[model samples]
Target: MAVLTERPAAPVRRRDRGARTLVNRFLGYAVLVFFALVFLYPFVIQLGNSLKTQEGAAANPLSPFPDPLTFAGFERIFAGTNFPLWLGNSLLVTVLVTLGRVFFDSLAGYALARLRFRGRAGLFAAVIAVMAVPGVVLLIPKFLVLNQLGIYNSYAGLIVPLIADAAGVFIMKQFFESIPVSVEEAARIDGASVFRTFWSVVLPMARPALITLTILSFQGSWNEFPHSLVSVQDPHLFTLPRGLADLVSGSLGKGTQYPLKLGAALLATIPVAVLFMIFQRYFVRGANEGADKG
Candidate 1:
């Protein structure tokens, strides 16, 4: 019999494989860092320009360093403009809208998820359809309704229209469906009414979804511009975004006024940024939970 000696197996290229992986990881990280800087460059410019003199900002709007830094822009923001009023309105509207959305969205979500009612499926479908509709499409109708209701140019118009949204209801409903029905059934077995079960048992367990909704609602109301544009024309009723727009549109009159405008815009961005940073972990969890349910 011919001596059959299996040729030695080719040496595994483990070293080359490891080196390739290392190179790939480095490139991936490099690309990510590059994009991060690109994305953040505008904000960096915004900050730098906000601290610059008007002449300095105008000369070098793209510069990320302020030469002869000053606070005159911030001073002008408060002393010369209605920044304080806009801030107060934003806070009030944000808080009320967040609270209303959390309550109303959760109620609607639970009803759709667990309730046995006529048109339940159809209502849920309609809610989904509403989410698909571009909000701009509703602007004319929204204005018409608000005008008819005689609430235009008032806080009610600003606050009420934003209190609850189809998106919030959809988010809450998806999250609710992920929860085990047995949990609510147990509450019911102990004689909890439908509303009581929702309030005491279900809502408490839906903390992630609630936080997500609160953050979204707060951000939406804080940055609300189109709604404010259509709802209120009074300068006194202007929210931060609307006021910022007015500030940029020759409200301050002549000259670039770059520092003052950027400072005001920067101040407007802080609340939402801080809120997101504080609740970022919960927000991510909520988003993941919603995604998994979907």
Candidate 2:
């Protein structure tokens, strides 16, 4: 019998495979870098324009370098516009909405997850249906309801309607279900009431989900514009988004006012960016956990 030997061509095949992988990886990285620059280019322009003089910003709107840097835009933001008032309203609405959503959504989620009740499944299905409904579709109904309730054009309208969202409830319920029922059983055996079990035992263990909810709620409320448009026509009650809209619609004197507009938008984005950065890991982990449970 002839002794069989591994083909020397095997090494050449291996080298070919290695070369293909290297090429693919380089191409992948190049693609990623290209998209990253594309996505980030507008933000770079925004920042640069915000620092430029009005004339320079109007002239070089697409440029990422300011010909003559100035703080006049930001200064005008505080001194000229109603930015301070808008900022305060935004902060207040965001805080209240975030807190209310966290508390109410968690409670609703726990009830849905652990409680036995008539029509529980139906209620959850309804929540799912609500989630499916486009938010804009509800705008007219929401406006009517707020008007009927005599809360329109008031902080109550702005804050109360957003306190609990179907998505938050869905997220919390999924996360709660992921916790073994045995844990709640243990708490029950120790004579913990339903509220006690949920509040102390379950809620404490639900830090990740809560953080995720809080961040979402804060961001949503902070960036809310349509609701504000329908809820409050009063300039004093205007949030950052509504105020920005007004600014864009020529609330300030004529000309693009690119520097001032971009500056205000930049400032509006900072809070959400900071919050996301701080809780990014927690948010991702919570979202993954909730998704897995679902």
Give me the overall lDDT of model 1: 0.88
Instruction: Write model 1 residue lDDT over 81-182, tens digit each, in one string.
Output: 999999988888889999999999999999998899999999999988787778787788989999999999999999999988888898899889998999
Which stretches in model 2 have alpha-carbon errors above 4 Å? 1-9, 253-255, 282-294
- Residue 269 displacement in candidate 1 (angstroms): 0.8
Q: lDDT of all the models against the reference?
A: 0.88, 0.89
Clashing pairs in 1: none
How well does candidate 1 match the true structure in TM-score terms? Answer: 0.90
* Model 2 poorest ten-residue lDDT run: 1-10
Cα distance off (Å), candidate 2, residue 59: 2.2
Q: Tell me the lDDT of candidate 2.
A: 0.89
